[model samples]
Target: MTTIEAPRSRPTRRRGVNWEKWGWLYMRFSGILLVVLIFGHLLVNLFLGDGVSAIDFAFVAGKLADPFWIVWDTLLLWLALIHGANGMRTLTNDYARGKLRVVLLVLLAGATVVLLVLGTLVLTTFDPCIGDSTVDALIEACAAQ
Candidate 1:
């Protein structure tokens, strides 16, 4: 029986920046923040005041009208989308192979970008009074503005 030879290895060297380490840290921190944001969102929308029944267009308009909620929603959108895209990239790297892996990663990036742009636009440019509606309350509110 011949003896097995040990595989040769290159010496490890320090690099400029370790992005993977930072990504791992980001995942942990963002997950914690997402939990809090999600819970607070649910609490306010589904459990407060008139509960889920109060979740009409007016409700959304009211929430988005506040600068605090605008910033909160923007943070939620960016963090969650980036976190999800990074996770998918990791998964693709782990399980995918050949050109399919590249395709998947590209698709993931495109989708994430598109969603982030759309979500941010919606959050920032939301006008509750853009359309004519039969709702007197909304009409009056818009007229008052």
Candidate 2:
């Protein structure tokens, strides 16, 4: 009868901060927050007031005029953008290889940054009176400030 050798232990690896673990955790928490934020946003915008028919430029201007809505939209923009980018990055790492993977990652990062910057700028610097002075209510509101 042949004698079997003892089983080997797992190999040692370098010690460092595990980014994948943090990323996984972030995905879970962010997903939960995103659902709440998205539903609240949809409920207020699409289901309340006059609904879809009331979604004109004036309505958007009014919404953005409030600091609460501005902050809400900014949160929505940043969280959604980063969440999507992280998901796409995970996919890229899993399925892509070589130069293709690098290129995709670079493109994804660039797009995410660009969108975040632009979206934040739009939210923070939005002037509700920039267009369409034809609406009497908007005209009065703009003049009041």
Candidate 3:
């Protein structure tokens, strides 16, 4: 017995902007920006000053004290997370199979959303003095009066 093949047809055209195309463009643009942001962040935090040896809670708290560093770090976090997530989605589409692909993609997207929300909250709502001991040296040096 011979099996019959079903005929294939073209999909109808839509009359609106193609969001997928914009998303693709956005991923590339954000990826380039992330490269710069991430490297600059690393260079400043790990290579500048006394190199990695100077990286402590006090150093980070000092940086977060400034609104400029807060905005810069916040933008870096947002862009890198989004670019990295989109890159993972591309990899997932290339390798994941069948129902497992759908499940993995759903989990990735959910995790990305949760991470972005939490990261943003931390950047925006962070208080350097939140856990400071009353006698903390840096707190006395930097805390707002």
Q: Which pairs clash in the backbone of model 1? A: none
What stretches of model 1 exceed 4 Å from their correct place? Answer: 1-11
Models ranked on lDDT:
2, 1, 3
Clashes (candidate 2): 0
- Can you give the TM-score per candidate against the true fold? 0.84, 0.83, 0.81
Instruction: Give residue 111's lDDT in candidate 2 (0 to 100).
Output: 98
Counted clashes in each candidate structure: 0, 0, 0
Cα lDDT of model 3 by residue, 1-145, tens digit: 5555566755557889986678799898987887888888999988988889998877887788899988888898788887788889889989998899999999999999999899889988987677754547856765755
lDDT of 2 by residue, 1-145 (tens): 5566567956446599888788899889989999999999999889998788888778888889799999999999988899999999999999999999999999999999999999999999988778778789889988998
Q: Worst ten-residue run, lDDT, model 2? A: 3-12
> Please, what are the lDDT tens digits per residue for candidate 1 over residues 9-114?
6545677788988999999999999999888888999998989999988788889989999999999999889998999999999999999999999999899999
- Candidate 3 local distance difference test against the native: 0.83
- Candidates in order have lDDT scores of 0.90, 0.90, 0.83
